[model samples]
Target: MSARITLASGVTLNTQIDGPDGAPWLILSNSLGADQSMWDEQIAFLSASYKVLRYDTRGHGQSDVPNGPYTFDDLVGDVIGLMDALSIETAHFMGLSMGGMTGLGLALRHPDRITKVVCADGRADAPAPFVGMWDQRMAAVKEGGLEAIADGTLGSWLTEDWRAANPARTKSVRDMVTATNVDGYVACCKALQKLDYLKSLGDVKIPVLFVGGSEDVGASPETMGAMAAATPGGRYVEIANAAHVANINAPEAFNDAIKGFLGV
Candidate 1:
């Protein structure tokens, strides 16, 4: 089932629910430019054992596109508000890239709301280089729109061999990137630029699985491994031959890693 639900924040998010009724809850969040459909491959596999809830983050997909300069508080509050609206006291959370960062924020700010977190291809902190990269991206988008950055984003998301072999899929993702609301994209970039959750990672008491692609330069395996080591009872899994969007580039390996971590 799918519907547009307005949260307490007055931001309406496009949400979809799947799987058997009364199953354990599992929430799936998308990356910066992508939507809920990014996890289409994992739906069947995950829904079999979980009541999967997939939603487009604010400013992406069919969700509300509020004004610029969204904060991690806004991002995390959106999830908390969504769960409260649905009466979901707790659920397992999984996200990639921007979505992954959301999971980390939830673990820190709302630990009671999530049992475990699968943060794939996400970082805990935005260092000087990371801030510089977002600055460049935001500037490009402001000047030439999302089209200017689509190619580079896609190239970073998937490896050359994978993109070459999966031309149609690659084009679809490119389309999604270009279709994003420019203002929303830039606003999200602003949030990403200010990421600073690394120092507080040790405060996360729940189990967290940090999944990284071997070829993902944006969130390298080394960085994810360090993040995993920082969090209590955290685990790290490196998907071979995958890039930033490892779930799309290597669904099987990604699914296996999450399944093992989630035990479902």
Candidate 2:
């Protein structure tokens, strides 16, 4: 069953917990436009050895969509709050894209709370050159709503062959993108435009795993691997024939990489 927890910050998040209570905890955080279901494929595999926790980020899933211009601290705070409510002291964290960025922040701010970190398809900083692009995206979403960005996002999220062969799956992903709350999307876009957590990673003293899709146009393997190398105990893996949503595009490979890393 799904649980709704009202955070200390006055934000309510929709969360789901599975697996045995005595097992080690593992939290799966989704990308910008996805909800807890984004990690559906990995649940059975992961839950076998872990108390798996999945949640919808504030603006993306069934969670509250607060008005715009949120900060990294706010997002991180939400996770901390959820952990507190669940009485979890620490857990292995795996996040994709925006969620991965949140993991980075959580590691830096609450290092004691994260045992291992997996940052998949996430970036540490946003270049100034991309500011204009982000502004344009925000403008488009505001003007045309989520429909404005669905096609472009899907194009970057999956490979051409995958889209062609998996039309139904592709449509499902498209639905996720277009269903995103416009206010949340715009707010997240604004946050991404100013995000910069690279320099702070040096203090992150936890084992880190960086997963990237070979074909991901947004966050490539080279970039994510470099991020891994920069961290003290960082490792890297690449899933071939995958794109931004590598976990979904290449579930077996993605799960293998994670299972091997976690010794599951």
Q: Any idea what lDDT model 2 has?
A: 0.87
TM-scores for candidates 1 onward, in order: 0.98, 0.97
What residue pairs are clashing in model 2? none
Tens digits of per-residue lDDT for model 1 on 65-146? 9997998888989999999999999999999999999999999988888999999999999889999989988899989988
The residue ranges of model 2 lying beyond 4 angstroms of the native Cα positions read none
